[model samples]
Target chain A: MSSPPRDAPGAGVLRAAFAVARKELGESFRDRQTLLYTFVLPLCMYPAMFWIMVQGVLVVQGQKQARDVTVGVVATAETAEAARGQLALDEEGRGRIEVVALDPETPRDADAIAELIEGEEADALLFLPDGRSEDDPAALFFDSTSSQSETARGRVVSALEGWTEELRAEAAEARELDPEVLEPILIQTRKINPSKDDGALVLSLLLPILLVVMCVLGAFFPAVDLTAGEKERQTAETTLLLPIPRLGLHLGKIFAVCATSMIAATLNLLALGLSAGHLLGQLAGLGDGAPKVELPLGALISIAPLAALFAFFVSAVLTGVASLAASFKEGQALLGPVQMLFMLPAMATNLPGMELTATTAWIPVVNVSLAFRGLLVGSASAGPLLLCAFSLTVAALFAIWFSVRLLSSEEVSLSSETISMTRILRILRPR
Target chain B: MTDPTNTSAIRAEGLAKTFHDPQRGVVEAVKGVDLDCRKGEIFGLLGPNGAGKTTTLRMLSTILAPTAGRALIDGVDVAEDPLEVRRRLGFLSGSTGLYPRLTGRETLRYFGRLHGLEGERLEAAIARAFDAFDLHAFGDGRCEALSTGQKQRVSIARAVLHDPPVLILDEPTTGLDIMASSDMIQFIESRREAGTCVLFSTHILSEAERLCDRIGIVYDGRMLAAGSLDELRAMTGKEWLEEIFRELVQRADAGEGAA
Candidate 1:
């Protein structure tokens, strides 16, 4: 009674907006369904999903490497004895490959060794002829696809090559000839791929795309639940009738949707990063020279801005469309296509040729995805980032504007346009 | 006439609303309706479903603007300054819901803040509401976990949390049990005694007959007749309000038939 009932003016609307936002936030966090989909589920499920996949790959690789492979030597008794001695010299190779000398009673030829390999008793074959001629065969045979067979073949060939070089040196010395004359040139290949940052190509393309997809997924339920959910709960009318301007109310709901989306996105980033980092550490232990790369800090940091922008654009668009929907089910019907529309660009950004560029900087969802990729790979420049940021910000603004328009319309906000029987029948039998 | 804005707690003059669809062209929902509710009086808008009762209530509450005319709540025009009108009014409907996750206290705090009450005053207001509504026992429970009667109580409490001068309720007790309905009726009666203007709509004839100081019978977006129970009985030459309602509807139908 001491003061006027209505607010003084402009500041009141803002205060009311914050009040609405606070309620929206408080209510959403308390909702069990919202909490599950937006926080708990993403946190627990993402790490588990990553764990299963990495474990599967590691198990397969480990089994293949640890499998024992038997190798058969096809040679005369003396030659077999010499070959067995040569293989025995390398103690570390013995654990992986079991070298067996064929009986002196059996023929030591390619066909005999082939039979042994074909019979599955031996994974590969090694043969050395009795004659000391270049024409006489000394061969290593194994299946190309089998890691065990390939390793066995490699061990036998290196041993034979070593014996041959030793014999050549002895013969050259006895004849007082220069061994350099026997070798005209030395050929070696320096491998560019045998060095530098591991998992760069795969993680660069993959982590960003996964993150973008997760961000979208994280925003989905909250955006749908807040706008359409409130209508279904019949709370929209009461909220709409409040003294606060409709834009203030709409913004409050939008912020709630965005907050849930960001939380889900951040949870996913952390879960994926930790699980993936652990997986990489485990994988590094398997090979001495293997490149050990972690899902980077910069990648997660880049996704932050991209996630916020993407979540903002997506949730705003959802709010606009959801405002048109009369119920939660109807919102799903409308938002499903919008979600697919967003998904295509997110997926496309992961393709080989979908790199960030001047032209791509203007495409709404694709630009963010590509820009996110560029940020992770260190290939994006400030100009493209600005361009991407500019376009998405505009799109977000447009969506907010459209949502405000929907909120302002009396017919749109007040009516619950349920699908009537007559309307349903008309759809069933259109004229 | 005296300025309706200056005197009435709630006022509407030739208030109307029309809906438009691409295929249907134009459909009038609330057509050129006029009414008034003064302080310390309860006005009942009696009508069946789809009879524009809700549409009229919506317009008065500032949820929907009148397409043809204007309304004022506590001297503020709804169409011109809906925010001002909403500030002075408390609106409740059968379909108005409580936030399922929030407790009874939180719901009151939420609406009170929206009405610009905060800090110590808001807290004190909530404490008063708790005692007034006897919401103390169940104030801590989440709304979703509460029973139907409790939910209704919380809903009504949310409407009056801001303590607006005018209360607009659309079928507020439509789904309530006998105990809950009696409780709501008692609450409305007390509000009238406290000098608050109460305007509500209902299809229950007995409720209109028992509670309203004056009743308006609405049909097909028009007020067929409006008066006290005795006045309606005298005008329609019927003893019962139900018979009066039947007679008024039949006469309107006959008029349409002749046309």
Candidate 2:
């Protein structure tokens, strides 16, 4: 038979990369483990993790909401009767001053008082010492270590002050004592930091950071497998030999990895969404509510493509470098460091006060993280987005070029010689 | 005696290849060899280990480029357009690989596509190869699961799936069982009858003597003799081709150049 028509060697070449992409997608779908790990597990894992975190926050908030505690009033009959009539008036809907009156003559015991704090039964103890008079103030004994106890201490002090004023007024009416002399000075304490009252300070930071983590974690396995795994299994040699273009193989694998990551990330986001109600209920004290966070539809759509691009760029660079490495073992060894480098920028977004910009947008790992954070906090700037997209495209192109060079390099293709310590020393030693 | 005007299926002119090691500098693996293999004939290239026979075959198959000179596969220069040369030829090395994960059928189909076969043609070709190689029993079996002989048969099946006009098989029967070897020998004879120019390389002299229409004695990268077995025997003044081969290679190693 004669040679093939020369007019369209280029057409076949163009389709080659797509063909490889298709094959990679098929292989990924074929593996049951890949599906479970990339898609199914992330879906279940993120919500479960979020729920646990929220549950912890909620338990603390619930204690904070209790506001006041019941304290034992151990005092004489005369003091007790006077304390009752003079007690601070409890208002409805105030969620305060829930006093469970204890026996006035009960002996003071540390263990019993400790049990009240530990069991969360009471907040404080009003200890009326023996032979206490109307002029003498009753000492409030409460655990400062307990947050509830501290709150209850404030309530007891205010209630006693009210009672002291009423006694002063009654004494003034009956025996001409001065109410002003009894209470001369009043100190007003106010909160200094207004931002603290806005609620859920960590929400803005944690959400963006979590989103970035989810994206990276989701894509990690598939990206490495698509490139390095092929080399390990020796399927790469057979793949390269195919009449399909090398670019097609690179693009195809990138798409597959990207798709896998996107699916995982999307499911993770959904899990977070479903658990949002519970998280809000738990953190209600921290903010007005769970900050009413939702991934904007536009942001979600943008994320899908962005994630795909990120996966492609990552896979291309890693695979390209791995292909050039000495052997399958060398490829895998090198991939870990490459992954770390990619993760560094994203991890940086988790730091307090770190912001994304156009200049830093070109920095690979950081850019993806920053972009993800911006999307999460509803402040994703267009400049940074465009910059990251450009940087990713450039990186992708570079990786493709590198891969092509690797493919062409006879030494890389034929020899699996790795550089060990011995080899390195051979280079270092004098001839 | 063959017609020169019909043109050689694989023609090598003054072919040379030198391998360079960073530590050892340059080693000349092949130097100044000329060969002409005719159509409808089996040309056996015989030499010991490190005799450069494999290198010669690799150059002809366009797997490796020669350092100097040229190899043509049916008139297409291997150096200028290797894919063209590859399209016309099928190559199988003794230790060439089959993907361990791929089934025998998958391997054949993949290679068939690589050689540019598609649609009905690709399927038909693969089916024919499966039938011809008697690989139906293990067609769906992964390459790693198959026995050594079965793997070799699959390799051959993949190599020849495109049914190229030229077949360059380098030590194709090296690790085969006696039965498999016999089957391969018979396959080559039949392919020759159907007009596929067969260049079969081996270290086994008796196999070469039995199979080749023309036998070339290669020593240290040079073809010492190229002719029918009888012609080679006549040139060395020996009764048997094996004796002639021994005498020529021995003489060349002893610093007596070819006559």
**Best by the lDDT measure:** 1
Q: List where candidate 1 sits over 4 angstroms from the true fold.
A: A1-4, A8-14, A68-202, A284-295, A298-303, A324-334, A407-431, B1-5, B20-26, B256-259
Q: What is the lDDT of residue B157 in candidate 2?
A: 88
Error of 1 at B115 (Å): 0.5
What candidate 2 gets wrong by more than 4 Å, as runs, is A1-11, A27-241, A244-288, A293-297, A325-327, A419-431, B1-6, B20-23, B219-224, B238-245
In order, the candidates keep a fraction of the true contacts of: 0.49, 0.11
For model 1, chain A alone compared with the true chain A gives a TM-score of 0.69
Quote the lDDT for A68 in model 1.
Answer: 64
lDDT of 1 by residue, B97-143 (tens): 78888899988887787777878988998998888888988988998
- Model 2 TM-score relative to the real fold: 0.71
Model 1, residue pairs in steric clash: none
lDDT of 1 by residue, A1-431 (tens): 22234453223656656677677778877777777867777788777776787788778766665566677877887888777777646444244557687664555555765567768877887766786658756767787766767767766676668887887887788889887667779789764653224555546666666656666666666666677777788887877777777677778777777777778777766676666656765755546566545566776686577668777887777776776667878877877887788878778777668877788988888887787667665778988888888888888888777666666665556557743335333333423
lDDT of 1 at A38: 72
- What DockQ do you compute for every candidate structure? 0.48, 0.20
Residue range A1-431, candidate 2, lDDT tens digits:
44433332323654655555555665665555567766666677666777787778776656564555566666766665555554435644333665555676555678877886687666777767545457655667789887778877876787777766666797776766676665688678865534322222334454444555555555555554555555555454445444344455556665666666666667765666556645654656444423444434455566555666676666556555565455545666766776677666666767866667877788766776667657655567888798888887887677656655554444444445543444334433444
> lDDT for every model?
0.75, 0.68
Q: Interface RMSD of the predictions, in order shown? A: 2.7, 4.0
